[model samples]
Each structure stands twice: as C-alpha cells, then as structure tokens.
Target: MTADATKRLCDVVLDETIGRATPDVEHERAVAIFDLLEENSFAPVGHDKGPYKLALSLVDSKLVFSITGEKGEPVATHILSLTPFRRIVKDYFMICESYYEAIRSSSPSQIEAIDMGRRGVHNEGSQTLKDRLEGKIDIDFDTARRLFTLVCVLHWRG
Candidate 1:
C-alpha cells in the first residue's frame, strides 16, 4: 500500500470511534488495507488471489500478510512496520486464544464473534474488535483450536 493509504488506515484504527464501528461499514479501511497489500508487491510463489490462502512474514521489524491464488501464487501482499503495534502483541495473542477456544467448542456464536473481531482488527476502522471479543460469553474448543493455529501463523515473526 502507498504510504498515504497506510497512514489513513492507521489513523482510523487509532481513532477513538473504532469501538463504535463495524467491519462491514468500513469500506475505506478495507480499501486502504488492500491497497497496502497490493503496493507491497509480495505475491505468493506460484499462485494468484482466488483460493483464500494467506501467508504472513515478518522481517526486520516489518510484517507482511499475503493472499494466494488458486495454484498457490500470491495475488496481494500487505506490509507494515511492527514498531507501532508492538505494544499490542499480548492483546493480539489473547484474542487469538479466545478465538481458538470458541472454535473448539463448536459454538457458532463464538466462531461468529471471533470472525467479527478478526475483521475489526484487520479492517482498521473497527475499534469494537476488541470489545466484541471481550464480550464473548462462551467458548468452542474446536473452533478455538483452528483459529489459534491461523492466528499463530499470522503473528509469527520469523
């Protein structure tokens, strides 16, 4: 993504109103994220962008998230500096754990909540991401396990 786009998304995420917004209503935020990923130009080894596969890389304090195509090629890549959000690492991990628990228990509501929370965190304008996650009243062991794995993959710094 362009510097301007990244700046915009970060601004939205840091804004006080994030807790009141939802991912579905954050078009600009989503666009900014996509723009960043596209601008970074880190396509997968042999794929495009159709299959919903995502890869993440962290190097020299930079974090990259990428989507792969049908054949396992990268179609989009998002790169960002880890310095600004380093303080939130623990929180991110905690949320991921909760998401995993929800998934493991086979609770649709928990899974949905985690999905929404994930969207809010990834989408950039939804502050409610954390709040929604905190509000989850139950846990699903199965969903939690899968979500934990996915989150771990995304947060890996190697």
Candidate 2:
C-alpha cells in the first residue's frame, strides 16, 4: 500500500486548561501550529485517517493527543506519560535561555554555538516524541519537531 501524502494535520488546538501562556510561549505555539499545518505527514497506524485535527493537552502528568476527523468526529486519543521527556524538556528550556541571552550580549559565533546546542536538545526531544508515538501515530521528523514545540508550550509554567 502506498503512503497517503494527504494524511496530515489540518488543524491543531491546545487545551484551554493549560492556562494562559506568556507572550513568548504563545508566539512559539502559534509558529509551531502554523508550520505543522503548512506541511505534515501524520498517519495513524491501524487506522486510515487523513487531514486530522489534533487537540493536545496535559492531564495528570500524561500528555494527551485528542485527534479528530475533518468534521470534528472522534478519531483517536493517545495518552503518553511525561516521565521520559522531563529531563530533555528541562535541558531544552535551559539551552534556549542561554541562546536568548547570547543574542543580547554575546558575539555572533557565541550565539551560533548556543543555537546549535539548542537545536540538538530540540532534536533529542523530538526523537523521544517520535519514539513514544511509534505504534500510535506515524509522523515524519519535521512533524515530530513541531509537535515537540507544542509539547513544550504545554509544559510552560510562565
């Protein structure tokens, strides 16, 4: 069977319960959603679904993916424990802080170095997300990366 290129996310929603995000976090979430909707390959394993809508949230320390059809019908709901991602997320945030600081006071080379480290940590988190969703959802690396951004947004306390 050929892979359906149409199997992608058409829309993304973050649970309101996550609370109001800070300006930076809101910007990140918006960008992630835009990038994700612009181009993504999200296919649910064992289920033929295309152009899905994803509603992401965190409940009881579990990350929830509440997927839906184009018409708002239920598709699939996958819950993943946040245990494996805690350390990586923490690292990513710390590196991001350094990168932001470098942008303000450091030289170009220093900023570049910090950005590289930030990307590396981001990739690790994305890979972990892909691994966690292995059997449930089949998403390409870029999609996973964008989704990881959303995951981090949900974890944002400020």
Candidate 3:
C-alpha cells in the first residue's frame, strides 16, 4: 500500500434503498467496501484528516458522497449528477452482463476478452469519478475504482 493510502476508511453506510439491489450489485458493494477498508487513499481538500465515515445516497437524482471524520463530524458532501457518467455506466453494465454470462460457458480466451472489456469500462468509470471529485477530494486510482463500483451498485436499482 502507498503512504497516501495508509489512512483507510473505518466505516461506510450505503443508503437503505440500495440494499434491495440485485445479488451482483450487492456483491460488488460488499467487495468494494471490503477492499476499500483494507486499503485506500481518501483526502478531502481543505479538511481535517480521515479515517472518514462515508454515507452514500441519491437525492434528486444526484449521487451524494457524504464524508465525515472518524468520530462522525461533517466533513464534506460531494453531489455528482449522473449525466456525465451515463454512457460509461451503461457500457460497464452491458459488458458485466456479458462477462458473467461468458463465465458460465465461454472458453478461457473468450472469458479473458470479456474480462478485459469489463476492466476497460471499469477504468473509464473510475477515471470519470476521479475527475468529478478532483477539487472536492483527492483519491488514488484504486480508491476511485472501488468507489466507482459502489456507485454502480447504487445505480443498479431495478
């Protein structure tokens, strides 16, 4: 782990509405949260340091990333509109579906190809999120990728 990632997340609270998510979505959330807690870099611009607790939710169609200090003091709230992420998220979902299906019957080479496409989409989402959170918070690529996965889980309400 990088020095920047030394201060990891101590707690996370996803919106209750997000709990009814599909098994895949729930799995994504679980894995991301687990990995994020194991290691991550989360530094909010111009704020006190963390071990932060994040409360993620959607309000008025906007995704909210609400962060607080370890003791739960309000640190910052970054609300992002889903417009810019629409294309990448849609593509990611499509590829993930195909990737999952491929795992059930496809050959190793075919599965590898689909997995590569899935990773590409995942990277796209991660980069977009990193850009969107640029000024408000500074997060490393790994953190951004995990965050993106969690965001996709929130978007999976169907």
Q: Using Cα atoms with residue i matched to residue i, what is each candidate's TM-score against the true structure?
A: 0.31, 0.90, 0.87
Deviation from native of the Cα of residue 6 in model 2, angstroms: 2.9
The RMSD (Cα, Å) of candidate 2 is: 2.5
Per-residue alpha-carbon lDDT of candidate 3 for residues 1-158, written as tens digits (9 for 90 to 100): 44753255677888764456677767777887887777777878886477788888778778888898988889889898888988998999899899999999999999999999899999999999999999998888998998888777767754
lDDT of each: 0.41, 0.85, 0.82
lDDT of 1 by residue, 66-140 (tens): 444545554556554555444345456566678888888867977998878765454331222222323221112
Q: Give each prediction's root-mean-square deviation over alpha carbons.
A: 16.6, 2.5, 2.2
Q: Candidate 1: lDDT of 85?
A: 48
List candidate 3 segments past 4 Å from native.
1-7, 17-19, 22-27
Q: How does model 3 fare in lDDT?
A: 0.82
| Residue 86 Cα positional deviation in candidate 3, in Å, after optimal superposition | 1.9
For model 2, residues 1-158, the per-residue Cα lDDT tens digits are: 12564588888988875677789878877887887887788977876756788898778888788998888889899999999999999999899899988899999999999999999999999999999999999988988998888788777766
Clashes of 1: 26
